[model samples]
Target: MLRKLPLLVGAAFLLTAGPAFAHVGAGPVDTFSHGFMHPLSGIDHVLAMVAVGLFAVNLGGAAIWLVPSAFVGTMMFGGALGYYGWPLPMVEAAIGASVVVMSLAIAFGVRLPTIAAMALVGLFALFHGHAHGTEGMGLGVSFLPYAAGFVGATALLHIAGIALGLGLDRLGNMPATILKRCAGTAGAIAGVSILAGWLAT
Candidate 1:
C-alpha cells in the first residue's frame, strides 16, 4: 500500500492538471449542479481542499472537526464578501500559497494547537471562497443556492481526504506518515505549478 502511494498521488495530479477551460462553463446552468461542480473544476481547489483534511488527520483530536468547521464557516463569509464585490487583495497568490503551505505541513507532520490549525485553515478558506463567490456571482447564478452547492461540494472533498487519511492510518503510523508525505510532495509540486502560472499572468 505504501509503495503505491506515489503512483496514486501522481495519477491524481495528472488527472487534474489539464486545461481548466471547463470552469468557464461552470455557471452556465445557474443551478445547484453548477455550483457543486465548481470546486472540482480546478486542480488548485482540489489540492487545497484535500490537503486540509489530511492536515486535520495529522493533528488528531478536536482538530479533526474544528479545523474543517472553521474553514467552512469562514469560507461562507468570504464568499459573501466576494459576492458583494469586496476587494480581497492577492487572492490568487494566497490560494496558491495555501496549497503549498498546507501540503508542506502534512509532509512534515507539523502539529499545532487546534485553534492555530483552525486559523490557518480558515485563512486559506477565505481566499478559496472569495474566488468561488466572485466567479459564481459573475455568472448570474442565485447566490444562496450556489453557495450551498459549493459548500456541500467542499465538504465532500474534505471527506474524501479524511477517508484517505483513515485508510493510511490502517497501515500503521510510520508507513502512513510516509505515504501522506508523498501525497504532500505531489501537492507541493502542483502548488508551485499553480503559482508559476499566476506569476506568468
Candidate 2:
C-alpha cells in the first residue's frame, strides 16, 4: 500500500494529461517567462521530457545522465533551426511519436547501448526543440533567454522523472519494476491518444 502512492500519482498525471496541447497562449510575450512556461504548458513536452529521464534510469549506468544531456544539447540545436525558420518534416507528428516511442521504451524496459540510447533521444529532441523554436519565431524575442528558460524547465522535468525512478528503485526490485512499467504503459496509452487526436496534445 505504501509503495503504491507514486503509482497513483503517476496515474493521476496521465489521466489529467489530456487537453493541454503544445504552445498554448495568445502570442509570444516575455522571453524568459514564455520559454519557461512553454514546456510546462504542453502535455507532449512534459510526457516526452519525463519519459526521457525514465528511459535513462531504465538503461542505468552512465546512461542515467548521458541520455538526458544529449536530449537537451541536441534540442538546443533543433531549437535554433526552428528559430531561424528552417523547416523540418513532420514536426508535430514527430513530437507525438516521440512520446509514444519513449514511453514504450520505458514500458518494455528496453535497454540499448549508451550511445544508441543517446542517439535515440537526441533524434526526438530535435522535433521538440524545433517546436519550441518555431513558437517564438517572428515575435522579436531574445532567443538566448527564451531558450535558456525552456532548457532549464526541461532539465527540471527530467530531474523529476529521475527522482521518481530512483525513489521506486528503493522499494525492492520487483515492485519498483512493476510500477515503472505501469507508468510506461499508461504513458504509451496517453501518447496514442494524442496521436489519434482524442487527447489533442
Task: Provide the TM-score for each candidate, comma-separated.
Answer: 0.82, 0.85
Give each prediction's root-mean-square deviation over alpha carbons: 7.4, 7.5
Candidate 1: worst 10 consecutive residues by lDDT?
Answer: 16-25
User: Which of the numbered candidates is closest to the native, going by highest TM-score?
Assistant: 2
lDDT of 2: 0.79
1-201 in candidate 2: lDDT tens per residue? 324433542443344333334542335645778778878887878999999998898889999999999999999999889888999866666677778778877887778889988988898899888877887677564667777889999999898888888889999999988998899898888877876667765
Model 1 spans with C-alpha error above 4 angstroms: 1-26, 136-141, 198-201
In Å, residue 139's CA in model 1 sits off its true spot by: 7.5
| Candidate with maximal lDDT | 2
Alpha carbon deviation, residue 32, candidate 2 (Å): 1.2
Give the clashing pairs for model 1: none
Candidate 2 runs further than 4 Å off: 1-26, 139-141
Give the clashing pairs for model 2. Answer: none
Per-residue error for 150 in candidate 1, Å, reads: 0.5
lDDT of 1 by residue, 9-63 (tens): 3443343333232222244435678778878877877898899988898888888
